[model samples]
Target: MAAAVLAGAAGSAYVVTVVDRPKPVVVSHVAEVLDGETIEVRDGDRVTRFKLVNVDAPAASECLHQESAVKLAELLPEGTPITVVRDGPFVAVSTQDGTLVNAALIAAGLAVPSVNGTMFLDRAKEAHHSAAEQRKGLHSPDIPCTLPGQVRAITEAAAAVEAQPLKGTKTELTVAADTAKTAIGLVDQLAKPGGLTWDAVAPVDQTVLLAKVTKVVPTLYRKEAELRNVVKGLR
Candidate 1:
């Protein structure tokens, strides 16, 4: 399932398959970074490995090697539950606020952007930018703007009350139904053996009937529980 990446406060819409009924969830601790692409997290005895999707960083043997790892390490702390987009075997890592960190790294010339399973760009640019002024090379360049720290972490409280999916909404549904011309005959008549099918609206008034159906309803409901969750930062 795809997880929505929040690019900014506006957020981006992404569709993920719903495998089960949606439930509120949270986590507390993370284990360690196995590599630039993989991280191991511990939930008590249940250790889960998350493979970062959409991008890859340099192997330790590469030029930036230690520098890149150090940067990722600095951004993360021990036991920080990284909120990730869990898709099957891999967890796509977005930023603490859902910004695309790996892409940002590539954009800032810190790491090469891997595409189609191969590193498309060479270290020519990365080396030039990261070669800190050690003369002997002891400097690490300051990170650029728009890199997300903590990668991403959904706080114990709700990040924001997610708008609940639209369901059982009569007004909106009625408007939708009214706009479409479909025969809505009696259930019994439709089910009859030799079906006595007839137009339910024998004398349909296009305008009057449309107005009588309903008004526009919102996308979702805001319950008190959801409000509390928003304040608590748990959605």
Candidate 2:
């Protein structure tokens, strides 16, 4: 973890926190395509599996899973060299043909956005929304997509936090922080095994973060109101 303090032109102090993350391990050459979002690759002499980050495709038994797999196969055929990068608990892929595989999959409507946080969250959301609007792939009129297990848990956690009392005091801030931390733990626990399937958890992580943003808004407003009252009294 890294921290820095900055002073603005107006003499306001801001504390910035940064987390140092290791570079993702890039694996070259695809050995196999397990499904829509999972792949096997050659990492030196050993073969390992890497999950695609920030996208969740249908499971084998679910509707459109085969279609999703077929689409992926078309995009990345056998022996097609590709690059895989593992970022923290998630993995991302880039095809030899210059395809940002995660974003591509979402755009094609082959998968929905995962609940976990991703660097490409905005792009993925736009793609998912477009696909949904057009009734593409798994988002077809007859075939609705189901929220992954982890996504469901995080959504519920966000709802629970939103339902809490907002007293707009230091106590409320403490409560909100604790609740948000608990939600993070719950999300971590919900992550599935296999690096590729891990992308399934990103969507809800993003959701929980947004919920926290909403929760903090009231506290900020309360503080601003108190400050205004003090200024008025002085005047």
Candidate 3:
């Protein structure tokens, strides 16, 4: 057994319970701000780098990345006390005052919930929705980032495909193929009759609309692959 001592009021002592193991994880002090979702921490003489869990911030070159980084820095400047919990390759960070850095980032619209997040995944998503509703940070209409409109449209189409019997069922492969076709049809309908011209949309909406095509195309192609597999398996 190992006893860990935590800082407290001058006359008070706080004993932390720690099991004796070959290697132990220790709470570290924030040493440097790496970016919106990454930081360097120091524990005694050892320094380590970790990415905050449950949130995915935009890249440095992407819109709103600098703003996101600034927000995080304001929340956790160097020497701030923080605790970290290992989550796979990354770590979840929380302030000594019990503020969750991950949730804070999402709630402020500085980051989105990671698709592969483990702990507090649903909470992060909820915070993201709240941020969007409030038009905070990058979710603001004037932020000039890719909007979620096309993302929502693609999500609806993907959900429609999932509603069908794509997986194991009594339904025939032809039915699955038809469902995939329907999903792709939804994507086609997103394009206006005028050929989705750049000049047609407002300047602000142009980047969002054009950028989403790359994102939506991959989802359509995945459904197309499923259709091809259904045809091949029918033989």
Candidates in order, TM-scores: namely 0.38, 0.49, 0.53
lDDT of each: 0.35, 0.57, 0.62
Instruction: For candidate 3, write residues 129-190 as lDDT tens digits.
Output: 77767767656645433344434555555656555555554355456556556646555655
Better of 1 and 3 by lDDT: 3
Native RMSD of candidate 3 (Å):
16.9
Lowest summed-lDDT stretch of 10 residues in model 1? 148-157
Model 3 misplaced regions, further than 4 Å: 1-26, 146-235
- The residue-by-residue lDDT of candidate 1 on 52-96, one tens digit each, is 544455565444445556555544456765545443444444434
Tell me the lDDT of model 2 at 235: 22
Point to the candidate with the largest TM-score.
Answer: 3
Superposing all C-alpha atoms, what RMSD in Å does each candidate have to the true structure? 26.8, 18.8, 16.9
Q: Which pairs, if any, clash in model 1? A: 95-151, 96-151, 96-152, 134-137, 157-232, 157-233, 157-234, 158-232, 158-233, 158-234
Residue pairs in candidate 3 whose N, alpha carbon or C atoms collide under 3 angstroms: none
* Candidate 1, residue 211: lDDT: 31
Could you give candidate 2's per-residue lDDT for residues 18-122 as a string of tens digits? 123443345656788889888888877889887777778888766568888888777777777766555446766666544667767777778878756455555
